[model samples]
Target: MRENRLWSFLYKLQDKQQKWLWLRSCYFGLKTTGPLLLLGILLQGLTLSFFQPHGFFYVIYRLDRQVWVPQANFIIHSLSCIVFGMTLLLLCTAVAWYRARLFSKKETIPSMVIALFLLFLFNFHTKRMPSARLGQVILNGNIPFIEVLFLGLVSAYFYHGLNKFLHFKSLWSIAGATVSLGIVLRGFKHLFNVGFFASLSGPLFAEISSLLGDDQTQLGTIIVREVGRNLLVWLGFVSPEQILVAHTDSDLSRANLSAALIKNNLEGLPHPLNIYSLSDSFAVLGGYGQIMALLLLFILFSRYRKRRRNAWQNFLPVFLNLNSSFLVGVPVFFNVILLIPFLIVPTVSILLAAGAIKLNLIPPAVYQVPLNTPTILNAFMGTNGNWDALLFTLIVLLVSMLLYYPFFKVTETTLYRIQKGTE
Candidate 1:
């Protein structure tokens, strides 16, 4: 049976066209089904967050929740998945090909080295959180980290396959490699004793400082999500009316959107709101102008050592969803050139989502999803399992990537000029 199954897999790969289709299918499937599975998981989370607040089990369980469950919500998930997923797939394919092509390489080793060695050297020993709370400090016995272990293993394999273009025949080798990673990660310790390296912002700031001059530049101002947050608030999405009243055609429109009459005022408790669009969550794909995307772009695609080194140095912070380093580092704060898209992208994202909400095309994101949650998950959780919001967030992210592309290229040019003593 094993031999027969193996032969079938081999045969599928033997046909080049079939192989491409399979790969594309998997990518699309992930772009599509991954969210549906996450949506169902989100549904379960919505169910649980109400009952259990302080348990570690709920956290890990939801973190580890697979999308394979049989659930009634799958239908809802599937519909949104197909609609948004295909759209996202197209957008991503286009950007990656023309705009973001050769823009990023997921180099784990060099990045880790620069990030650890450099950030530690730069942080000045500013502690951010308790060792136990900071993670990486305590690698074992933290049940919440089970999610990390599995996620890391999966990511390691997925990226490995992508980077190496492994074939079906390499499945066993891949499995063996994954096991090896698990073993390695389990034994690894935070030997640098560098809490600040892990916690504090570093190298990206140097990159920004280099290009945009220094703190003396009036342009040294940083991006503060000034675009997305204020717009959503002005549009009444952030601050929804207490009661939603039905009215004439004009009033029934998306512009007249309102939230649930009751909000979770239980001191620290969070509840659903109907009026909040995904403005804040979708504002930045990976922080201001989705600059983390820019970091990855530079790291993988940049021809300059300055950019590549700084990008890798900041990659850890960016991946951790800490982007101020990149922002202040890039000095996107004051670079009028970069700042244009920095502000405009979020504004567009906010308006796009607000218009959608006004039209009742998608739901508002009222759930206070965990803060600093990355990308699509933010869309999912912030909307309280609303797939439309997740899809919309992705669309916003895609557009944001495009918006950032030209500016990124310009930044690269400026850096090149600086290198050549032309600027």
Candidate 2:
């Protein structure tokens, strides 16, 4: 009965309408830009797979004389930026127009113009405009999606507030208001990028290294720290490498590698539960949080054809360990139902892998694998072709799918209801 009540509460929360204009606008903006964001991510993934040195195609195919790859990469990247930049512009315009239309039809056009001009200033003054050459004004990978979402909603609210209260009519007044708001929000954007937790990455890495160095550090504590790192990535404040790749160069990793070489086996190493040995090997099946499991869920069970299509499109990229496609495409970034499984699956996978290692079922992954290695095979390759490690990874993936099933079902149901309502 209590479980049913909890489920009811969750569904109610999901179904509730946003009260604030900014919140509603943000959601609207995200929906409006969904296709564009997916396109950008697809191009970004293509660039990663085809052009990057450690990319899936590059490493796997061993292209000896790829003369065209760099040019193709440049074109793809530029196109991606154009798509995302336009998406940002459209998002801001959509929000401002929506808010202004709510006030008075007369205010909508001016509000959009103000919003666009302000965005121009925000980009130009911040040196993000013309990201490379020819005044392209693209939002590149450096600009996190969180910032894009924030700027869209906040800028729209700013213009809406002006329309609501100031009611400025003169051209000069509108331009002046835009410039002033742009300057202030640009500062805020800079500060938001340099987030509180982001600054702690250096110290956090040091602390985690110290903990790993301590022979008495328990496996449970390390798992907790790993979960914390995933939380940061989920929030889009920190890169997955900042925590998951924390101790790569440390003495612990080197010692483990050396020990593995000497013994020709992975068992009884000095460090059995480091981030790489556990998280990289097991937890990050498809780029942080075992995203492959979710992709599988989408392909097999999604009610919406769009969801299934995006899932199929995201499959190869995520399999190659480039998950930005799924991240913004399905937009798991700020999603509520998906967040639960996103965090839980990784935690459970890490625990299971750790348990397996402790019980001598499979040795910890000690060796470093190639960058483009399919995440499912990281453990197997690191353990020198251990079939057991490969089997264990499959087991973890299966478990993750099981963990993700309930949440994904809820997501599908919600999507169905929303689709019906819209139709």
Candidate 3:
């Protein structure tokens, strides 16, 4: 009952004119850049799966390394930069155009150009050559979603606000004001990065880890970290792996693997509740927040054709555990409505998996798996082809479906109203 009320209150709050306008603008901005972001996600995944170390093209497919590696490297890096650059450019352009249309219709073109100029200015660094800026958007594991979203929104917001507040009639004056805003904001960003975030994040993480203790095998600790990572991702930050690195990489994961290798069985390895055993194998099906369940919900039941179509478009990528498309398109990022299930579904799934492991219904997923493996089979692969593990994975997914269905309905209804421009 309380959960329903919270969602109801959130929906009511979002229906207000100001909030709705912001949401509509964000949605529009996403429409402008969603395709490129999706492409970036797909390409990044493909590059990792086919070209990176232990990639299928090398490890599984046994491609000729000498011939393909160099070309693969060039193609992957170049395409990633190009796609990200295009997406970032489109995001700033779309936001500037939309915000300027709302603020001062006559100056929309200037606003857009200034927005692009600001993008170049923000990315420029005095110490590095121009091409080095491309490195910033290389679409590696650490995609700068937060930075891109922040800069695009802030640049456009400042442009609109300055034009509305100061009535800058001249494009030169507008440009100057924007330059000033960018300089000031960029300085603050640098300070936060070098000084504030540097000072706070490390110690803060250490403190949390200490509190969580060295024994990450505890299911409660795993649950907290899993939920925390999802929350961070929803807020558009990179999910910090320090909290819970993949089971394949962590110390506990190593110990578990070594033990399993020594025993030649899956009876009682250490760290059964580590991320690989639970979160990666079960909770994060279809990337963070079990988005596969939501996509399935959309494909099976959503009344909106666009939503259903989008579900299909993103399915293949999400199936391979690349979910930036839906994250940007439906924009689960910073979406409070979906945030509920985004956190809840994963938390519940982890708990269910942990319970199954505890009861010995299935062994913990201690084995290492390949990159870009189908998420449903992660547990099966990790458990050395354990059919019970596969069944458990499917059960968790069905539970996610049940948990996500109601929220999906709410999201579609609200989006329908937004799309129809109906208050």
Pick the lDDT winner: 3
What lDDT score belongs to each candidate, Candidate 1 first? 0.41, 0.71, 0.75
**Across residues 1-423, which tens digit of lDDT does each residue of candidate 2 receive?**
998887777676666633455556656666676677667666766766667676656666875368888788889878876776777777678767776666667767876776677667666632445654545343444454455555555555666677568887677876788788777877776775677444658788667666645332366766676677567566655311121232345566778999988987776899887776777789989877789999998899887788899889778767867675576566665566677888889999988998898899998787766555678888887888899999999999999999999888877777677778889
Residues 1-423 of candidate 3 have per-residue lDDT tens digits of 998897788667546523755455656777888877777767766676677666534556755456877588679857876776777677767876776677667657776777776666667655467655544423233435566555666656776676678777777887688788878877886887577766667888677876455447777787887788788888878511111224577788789889999999998776677778888899888888898999999899999898889889899878877777787777787677788899999999988998898899999888877656767778998889999999999899999999998778778777778878864
Candidate 2: regions farther than 4 A off: 17-24, 65-84, 91-111, 114-138, 189-221, 236-251
Candidate 2 deviation (Cα RMSD): 4.6
Cα lDDT for residue 169, candidate 3? 71
Ranking by lDDT: 3, 2, 1
What TM-score should be assigned to candidate 3? 0.87
Tell me how far candidate 1 lies from the true structure as C-alpha RMSD in angstroms.
20.6
Residues 200-249 of candidate 1 have per-residue lDDT tens digits of 55576566444433111111121223453323322212200011111111
Ranking by TM-score: 3, 2, 1
